[model samples]
Structure formats: C-alpha cells, structure tokens
Target chain A: MKHTLAVLVENRYGVLSRVASLFARRGYNIDSLAVGVTEDPTISRMTIVVRGDDLVLEQVTKQLNKLIDVIRVTDLGSEDTVERELALIKVNADVNNRSEIMQIADIFRAKIIDVASKSMVIEVTGDENKIRAIEQLLKPFGIKEMARTGKIALRRGPKSV
Target chain B: MKNINVYEKYDQQSDRMTGRTEKMTGARAIIECLYREGVDTIFGYPGGQVLPIYDALYDSKIRHVLVRHEQSAAHAADGYARATGKVGVCLATSGPGATNLVTGIATANMDSIPIVALTGQVPLSMIGNDAFQEANITGITLPITKHNYLLQDANDIPRVMKEAFHIASTGRPGPVLIDIPKDLTTELIDFHYPETVKLRSYNPTYEGNIQQIKKAAEEILRSYKPVIYAGGGVISANASEYLRALAEKVQAPVTTTLTGMGAFPVDHPLFLGMLGMHGTKYANYSIQESDLIIAVGARFDDRVTGKIRSFATNAKIIHIDVDPAEISKNVRVDIPIVGNARKVLEDLLKYVDKAPTDDWLQRIAHWKRSYPMHYIGGKDNIKPQYIIEQIHEACKDAIIVTEVGQHQMWAAQYFRFSEPRTFISSGGLGTMGFGFPASIGVKVARPDKVVFDISGDGSFQMSSQELATVVQENIPVIIAIFNNGYLGMVRQWQELFFDKRYSYTCIRNSVDFVKLAEAYGALGLRVTQPSEVRPAIEQAIASGRPTLIDFWVECEENVSPMVPAGAAINEILDLERKA
Candidate 1:
C-alpha cells in the first residue's frame, strides 16, 4: 500500500541529509519527495509518499519522529485533509478543438494561463486523481507538454500541516 | 545557570564511601567519567604517555580489549557502532599509536558511524616541541572527526568526555575525539560531568521544505521516464518505505549505490545492486540511461560515477542528503531536496500518483539480461564461489566480517546478505587487521547473531592474538581463512602488473593454525579436499566454539573483475585463467 505523509521540520544544514541518511540506512524507499517553506521561513514541510507493508510504514514514521528537527509527522490518508496538486499542461489547440478544450477546463474549474496560436496551456489544481482525470480529458487534443507538482496535503479545520 | 554535577546520584551518596587516598589526575578522571557513564568495554591498546590511562584503567571497572594495532580499535568501534546504534569507544596512546588510529577514524568519518576515540598527547607545553612520543593527534584527526577537543585544561576532562559522547551519538553521527595532555592527567580538577552541551557551531537539522516537497511531487508527476537512485541515505534516513511508495506510485525503477546494498531488499524488481566500481553492468547502465535520477542518501563517489561529467547526461538529478557539503560537492543536481530523506519523501508521497510503467520495466529487464554480474569460477573441484555459497548457507545471515585481501573480494562477490550492518567488512579502509576485532565488535553489539571472521592467511595473522579475546569472552565466531599461503592480492599484483619475481610474498611456514586454535582453546579444522568444505563449515557452526577452517585453496588463485586502484570504474582486469 502507498501512504503519503506530511512532515514539518526545522530548516537547517545537514538536516535533510540526516533524514535521507536515516531512510537509506534503514532501507526505506521514497517514491517522490518535495520540500519547501511553510507559513514560517525557519520551518519547512515535507510530503513523502512511500509504499510498504503496514508494519514497515509504522516503523518508518516512528523512527522519523526521533530526529531532532522533525516537529510533526502525519499520515494524511486517515485525516480530513485538503490535498492539492498543480499541473501546467500544454496541448495543441485549433479553432475546431478550442471550444471543446475550454469546455472540459470549465468543468474542472481549471484556468487557461497561456495560449499561443497553435497551443494553449491549462493550469489545474486538485487532488492527484482529479489532476489525472483533467489531464486525460485534454490528451485527445494532442498534448504538447505537461508539468505537475506531485501532491501536497494540509489537514482541514482547526489543525494545520 | 553554570551548574555542574559530579557522579550525582539522585538518591544519596555518602561522600566518604570511597575516600581517595591516592590522588586523581586528568587521566584518572577520564577513566572515572567513562566508568560513571556505564561504559563496559573499550577496544584499545596502551603505549608511552597513555600508560597513565592503562594504569588507572586497572583500578576501573571498564574492561579494555587490547588490539595488536591501533587501527583495528577504530574499525572495531565502527563495527560495534553499526551493529548497535550507540557510540563506540576506542583509546590509543601518543605518537605512533595516535598516527595508527588515523585510518580507522577516517573510515568512521567516511561511513558516518559514531565512534569516540581517546588519544594521549605528550604534554601541553611540549605540544609544539615535538618531544619524544609527541604528535599533533588532534590536528591530524580534525578533518575526519565531527568535532574534537584538545583538553589542555584539566578541568575540562569530565565535560569533554560527556560532550564527545553526546556529539558522536547525535545528529548526522560520526567519530569524535578528546586528546588529553600527559601532564594534565597529573593535574587536579574538581570532577563534575556536564549534562548538556552548548555549541553555537554545531546542531543538525531534520525537517523538510514544504515547497520543495511540492516541487518534487510536481516533477514526479510530470516526468515520463523517472528512476529513483537510492543510496545509503535511505538506510541512514530510515526512509526505505517512503522511497518505495514514491517509486511504486510513479512506476519508477530503483537502483542503489554500493553503500546502498540493503536499503531496499535485493530481490525487489526495483533493486539494481551496488552501482559502482565492479558494480553490476545493468545497474551502472541504468543510472546512465535514467531520465530523472532521484539520488537519496548517497554521495556520487568517484567509484560510482565513471566519468563525473558524463554521468546521467540526460537525467535531471534529485540530490537528497543531510550533509550540506555533499550537496554540490559532486554532481550537478536539478532538484536539491535538503532534509531528512524520510521527511522529504513523506511530503512528496502526498502528491505522487500510483501508476505502472510498462515500457520502462520492459526496457530495464532487457538491460538486466544483457549485462549480469558474471563469475567464471567453474564447476571444478573446489571452486571459490561454491565455498562462499556453503559458508553463507552454514551461517545464515551471520555477522560476516572480512580482512582486506583477495578473499575479501571473493566474499563480497559471493556472500548474499539481506540487510545493512550484516556485512561488516572494512569497505572504505580495507584494513588488514579489521576482520578479527570487527567480528568480535559485531558479536558484542549483536549478541544474538552469529558472527564470522573471513580472513586470508596474510590478513588473519595481523591480529591473530585476539583469538585470546574470543576464548576469554567465549565468542564462537567462525574464522574461515582462505589460506593461499602467500600475500595473495599482492602476489596477483606481481603476476599481472609486475614481472612474477615473487619477493616477500610466499608464506613458506607460518605457525600451525590448527595448533594455534587449539592453543587458544578453539576448535580447528583443516579442509583439504573440495567435498570437505561444507561439512567443515557445518561442524564449525555447530561446535559452539570459535573455529578456524584453514582452507588450503589453490596457491595461485586470483580475484577476478579487479578495478585498478585509483583508476576509472569501468577499467577492470578480467583475468581468471591460471597461467
């Protein structure tokens, strides 16, 4: 099973290496990883997705907690989390297919950011599945380029990630 | 709040319990602090000025295991550290003794294993005088250590000892040292151990960047042909599961660096074993062909990157590590994810999609079939490969340690391990005396696991005296010596690189190893025939005592797939044929 975990840690030198080193030493497989500042510049939040047996995932989360810089770790799967991803997809659009492409974009509430005579870039934001679903709809129009930010999740309500 | 406590028992201690009739010196304070810290053992030796530590050690509870050489102590400590997560301790006296420990310290530094080394200096005044048995031990080990202290002040003894242990065991974890002046050992100080450390220069980070995590996720979703180049970092970060999810989600194949052996299970389809000098051809090729190389916790050692400029030419590299120095030190990276691998990986996993890569898997499978790690050790009488296989079978995932020689190479080529800290050979140092003491250290660290010392005749004799330690400690390690009766690897060097005028290579008559083992109260076996190898290993494992199987291998046998020392990774001498 795949589990995506959100982590908040102190921004300091060698902190990332230590965490990566812990994963490497412990034999954890990180599929895709992204890190950046949250609301505060001193702290950074990381969203990690891993695939493993339930026991191994539990062990990984437990071990991650021991690092000094790691302030919080949460598996957003069981939480009421607001997950979002952004994809800038460029597809070839002609006068005949422009209306159809715009119609699908309208359905997902995606925005048209850039448009050339031959191609139009559509920016979409949602969960992973929603982004994939939107990308699938635009493929028939001859997809020219695609760029996606994997996934980032924040717990909804009084709690924040 | 400059408060200090000396052996403070929360309960109560009558100050008059053990009135010190004798004076306490800086040297005695070191031993006293170590005893208070509950240190049970130290792998070290005594010489010159450090005789003070040894003398004080006699009255101490800590048992010191004297290594024949100082370097072995460092390696032993490293082995102990890897097996157990605690910081390993080692001690060596001044000058030559201190100089000898350099290799082991560097090894610990390179591998990021935590070790605390104590070395003696001549005296504070004589430091720059180059007095008898005086060398700048602190200056020499400065670069390799996480931090080091020159305890010219007698009052700093307890505090330095406490801080060294703390620094060594915490954060990125590597070796630390405390060098005491011989004169200071005689100087008196009010003994007090500092509980906390306040160092403005130190302190490691652990968190990941939320934006970077989002950016990486974006890359993964957009990348059509991505590959996760996992390193020892996965093991270090304790992030194997996170790495796996990220790979599986995007349908990315994974390859590991040499240090990354057990980060992922070897049998996993994603695992491409040990990609570096003498690495699998498929593994090396995969890194070269990868579109997006997600390097977890590994440094692109020169051995791993054939031609640094040409490495992963078309790939966008995602370099993740804890050491900031390591980030831009080697390869140029497109995404520099600076945080714990598990944390960074955890955040990135949120946005990755679980999808299958049919085309990439097919292409990789073809590469695997095309370039496999080959050993032409034929199905002849007693092949080295067969011998290694039988040893592995006899000692199922035992803590197998090796001395540096051709046998070390053979063992690496043959032994199948499933985890890190199981294969405890001196990978970076390749020290000769490494095996016996390292085996002891590993055994000490993991008492439940069976440990074995795999040595060649040349390597075993380095610290063969430690057999006494085995008999005394009742450690039942299997010492399988591939006795080619010569300094095997160098002889091969003489044969290949130099004209085979074998000088100082032949071991015409060494001490009878059978009697040697018997003398140490260990079981001994001399396996001559090919058929006897398996039974010998079986009997040795079952003996429940330290056993040495001196296998009289073909005298001229050589290690194949040799990478010329300090040469390009791809340059190998494929010479297995006997002339």
Candidate 2:
C-alpha cells in the first residue's frame, strides 16, 4: 500500500538530509517527496509518498516522529484529504494536432502554458489519476519533455493537519 | 516551562547569572559552558582543526584524557555515560578525525547512550570549498545522531552547547553532535550561556496513557504464563528496582536482552537469564509458550524475535518504552505504553496484584533443569567457559565490559551481574574494539569499583593501542583476552552453516599481547592452564596498573544452544554438552 505522510519539521539546516538519510539507512524507499515552507516560516511541510505494508508505514511514521527537528507527522492516507500533482508536458504538435491537443487540454481544464513552432507545453494540475490521464492523451502527440511535482496533499476539512 | 524545569535541575549552571556579559573566544565559551554543565572531564584526540579548543583547555581546570583514536574517544565517552548516568562528551578534529568517530557514534545511537560529540570543521568560508581537513560531519552523522548542528555564528555557542547537553541527556537519551568550524573557535563573542531550552516541538511524553495502562493491567491480570522481557532502557531509566518489583508482584519470569544484562539480578529465582538468539534455552522456551509478555523498555529486535510471526505466538504483549516508535516496529503488540520505563513500571506496579503461576513456574523449571548452559571441562587446555566462571567467582560485583564476539556471549552466560550498570558491552552495534577503551571510561567513572574487559584475541587487537592511554592516564583496568586463535563467532557460524569453510576467520596470534602491554608500561600476564586463571586475575587487580591477561583457550569451541538464523527462538539447535 502507498501511504502519504504530512510531516512538519523545524526550518533548520541539514534537516532534509537527516530525513533522506534516515530513509536510505533504514532501506525504506521514498516514492515521492515534496517539501516547502509551511504557513509558519519557521517550519517546513514535507509531503512524502512511500509504499510499504501497514507495519512498515507505521514504523516510518514513528521514526519520523522521533527526529527532534520534526514537529509532527500525520498519515494523510487515513484522513479525508485532497491530493494533487502538477505536471508540465511538452508535446510535439503541428497545426493539425495543436487544435486537438487544445481541445483535450480544455476538457481536462489544463492550460496551454507555452507554445512554440514545433512543440507546445501543457500545464496540468490535478490528482495523480487526472494527471496520468492527460499525460496518456499527450503521449499520442509525442511528448518531447515532461516534468512532475510529486503529490502534495491537504485535509478535506478546515481542521489543521 | 518544561525546558526551564529540566535545566533548573542542573541549577549550578543557572545561578551564575551575573547581569554582566564578558567577552571571550568561542573556544573559551565552549569550555565555560561545559564547566557550568558540571562536566569535569572529557575524552578526545587533538588535531590542527581542534587546536583552538585544546589551547583553551590548557589553562582550564577541565581534565581531558587524550585517546589514541577518535573512535575510542566516543566509546570512552559512552562508557563514562553508562557508568555514571551522566552525558558523556567526546571531541575530535575535522575530516578523518570526524569520520573515525562515526562507528562509535552509531554504536551509542543504536543503544541510546547519552553522549555529546564535538568535532572541528574547516573555516565557515571554506566549508563547501572542501579545504584542508574539511568534512561535512554534521551531514555525515545526521542519521546516527539524535540531533546535530553546524556552528554558524560564535554567539550561538552557549545556546548550542546547552542544547546539545540537554538533548543528549533527555528523553530516551542518545548521542548528539555539534560541528564547530576552526574560525568559530577563534572568533570572540560576549558569552552568556542560555539558562533554558525552549524548543516547543521537542517535548517528550513521560506518562503512559491511562487507557493503555488499564488495558495492559487487564492482560497482566488474566495471564496464566507471564514473563517480563526487559532491555537496556530499564537501566537507562534507572528503573531496575521497579522492574524487579513488578516481576515479583506478578510472579513472572524475567528475561533480559544483552544490554539489559544487569537490569534484573541474575541470581534471582524468578530470573530466566537472557532471551533471544544467543539466549538461554529455558527463557526462549518460556517466551515461545507464554500467555502474556510484559516487554519493558525492549524493542523486539530481529535477534530477540526470530521468525517474528512465530515469536511468542500464544502471548499477549504489553510493550513499555520511552520512544513510542519502538513499539510494534519489529513485532506487533497487544498493548503499547509510551513513557519513561521507571514511571511506567511504577504505574504498572499499582495494578500488579499477586497472581498464582505455579504451573508456568514448574514448566520453566523443568526446561531449566533439562537444558542448562554447560561446557565440557578438559584437563588438556583451558576452556573459555571455565575462565568466565572463575571470573564470576572471583569478582562477582566488579564492573564487567566485553568486546563483541564469542567471548561476549560466553561472558553473558557464565557471569552473574546482580546490579544495574555492571555489564556494559556493545549490544546494538556489536563493535569489536569497544571493551578495552570503554573499560578506561568505566574505571574513570567508578573509581571505587574494579573494571575488567573480557575480550577476544580478534576483537582486542582492534583497539589495543588504548593501552598507551590507560597507562598514561594511570587508569588501571584489567583486560582478559580469550585467545582462541580465530574470529570465534564467525567461525562458529561457518562451522555450523558453511561446512567449516573458515576462510578469513582463522587469525594468527602474531601479536604478543603480553609484550604489547609491557611496552606500554602496563602489567602483562599469560595463563595457559586452568589453575593459573584466578591467580593471574588476582595479581592484575593487585598491581593497580593497566594489566592485560592473555589466556590461551581451546580453539574451535562454538557457543551452543544456538538458534539458526531466521528460525523461531523456540526451535533452538542444541549440541551435546556434559551437564
């Protein structure tokens, strides 16, 4: 099972390395990890996606909580949460496929961020499934380049997580 | 407020708050902070990067023991901490010096020993440039240390030092590191050491949850066959008395981990000795067949829980530990109580009404009588087990330390440690060179007690250079080397599973340890006969100088009652031994 953990840690130097090193040392693989400054500048929020069984996930959460720099850890997978992944897809598009790509992008509510003579960049922001859907559709048009910011999540309600 | 209360306990540092600030170098600030923290001694090796700190120590009253290697410095500090229940301090310079301390720091971290390691770094401006003797030690030690810091400013010295001590000594105590650049040591600042720490997110839970405790109590009350499996945390929390009381109240058999050797009196009737891979046959059997297991301060490690699914299959486990993460990390539990071992044990004692477990006790007694730890006594050569037994008889109350290998397990089995902090060894990391240097720290901490390092010919050679430090510092510690002419543990494994393919396990006794000791100005004794063991030990103690006793024991003697790796602890592989 894949588990998403929302970890809030002190904004201190080497904290990221500490966390990354922990996973590496323990032989736990990180599927995806995205970190940024939280509402409190002194704290950083890291959305980490890891694949493991219940016991392994529990161990991951507990180990993260043990770090002194870490403030709190939440298993967002168990909470009512909204998750999103942003992707930028640059596809080789001509006049014929350009209009078709625009239509497909419009259906997905994606934006044509940049347009060039031979390629067009499509920016898509949605959950993993939605992003994957758009990426698949763009694949037929030949995706020249692509970039993705791994899943970041937020609880559904107003409650702080 | 919590931080204030914690620091106030060390009030000596809190009272000297003269409103005036005095200008001093960062190196002086480090020394001053240590003094205020009641640190009178340090273990370290000096180098160019740490020259500033050493210079500050030249005129100061703090006593610094110069170690031969940076690794020994960390181990010595760890031994000092375990012996005195105080945060140990180790210092080293940059690059190789800092890297050498990695193994020792990891060893301390694995066992949760309270230690503060200070290392020198290149100048702040030269940090990323990879200047001479520069290493990102804080980054290198990030995973091993509980917390680490790189000195960014000289003004942060006092706060960093104070916090380092606080973090190292508090909440499931573990090693912390602070890497100071050479420039920071020379930079001057107005020093005013912080009185308290205010890290809001760093508070640790000390009291177990009431509902969880209640559930654990119900399980304990309903148990027919109960056992108390204790670990190093009991000793760390100074809760051995509480653990003993709880065991007595429940009439439960007590088994300990390697690090938990002295957490319960070995001679007690209810004690089942150690339980795990190298544990006693009876204790492992009892754990496998128990109805309830009250795990105190022990993380059910792979060694303790072989084939985790089959471990304690019929038992309901109640795990009590200071670190909540340790619970269910390796093995699932019925009830988890997160708190200090001493406090949690006291809480459990409230509900531990006297219970009748005659049937369980009788079953365990049968196992004990039938499968006791025994060895063959031969007239031709000295047996390692016989030497351990003699040491037990001669110095029953002495502080015994061990380097990791066959000798460690033999010592654990043959010797009886009746008090906490008596048996100190490298349980988690199993580092080979720990015992010798660690004994020096132990002797320094407990000057009134006799200290001995039971070592192997293979393990002792790793840190034998420490004899120079021991002789120079005038710290008298006895070293008992079990000369089997092989890396005995790996050899045992090879003999059992790999069809006697010894490979590199056989080590030539090329180094004359007796001459090695004499060269370092220490007493050296060699004993090849069984009758000579006790006399040599007695003579070493009487000499009152650093002494090394080289005992030539029978080669290829394997530690028995072993559990094949990945098999359940209950399915122990036994070899024929004369009882």
- TM-score of the first chain alone, every candidate: 0.88, 0.97
Identify the runs in model 1 with alpha carbons over 4 angstroms from their true place.
Answer: A1-161, B1-29, B35-38, B59-61, B125-132, B186-188, B240-251, B377-380, B485-512, B554-579
Model 1: per-residue Cα lDDT over B1-579, one tens digit each: 111242243112323323332346777778877765567778897888787788777655566766667877887788887776677899998899888889889888877778999998888888889799888876677557776777868887877788888878666678998887888887877666666776533556667677777777777777666778877667666787787777777888877764565566666777666666556656666777767777888878876786677677888887777665566556777777777778888887887884445776788889778766565554444556568888878876777788888887677666776666666666555578778888877877787888888888998998788788788777788898888789988899898778897889999468689889999898989987788999999899888898888887777877766555555444545666542
Candidate 2 off by > 4 Å: A94-97, B1-20, B576-579
iRMSD per model? 11.5, 1.0
What are the TM-scores, per candidate, against the unseen true structure? Answer: 0.69, 0.95
* Candidate 2 residue lDDT tens string, A1-161: 89999999999887898899889988998999999999899999999999999888988988888888899999999899999999999999988789999999999999999998899999999999999899888898899999999799999988988
lDDT of 2 by residue, B267-372 (tens): 9999999998889999999999999999998989888889998999888889999998888877888899999999988888887676678899999999999999
RMSD for all candidates, in order, please. 18.4, 4.2
Docking level for model 2: high
What value does the lDDT take at residue B279 in candidate 1? 63
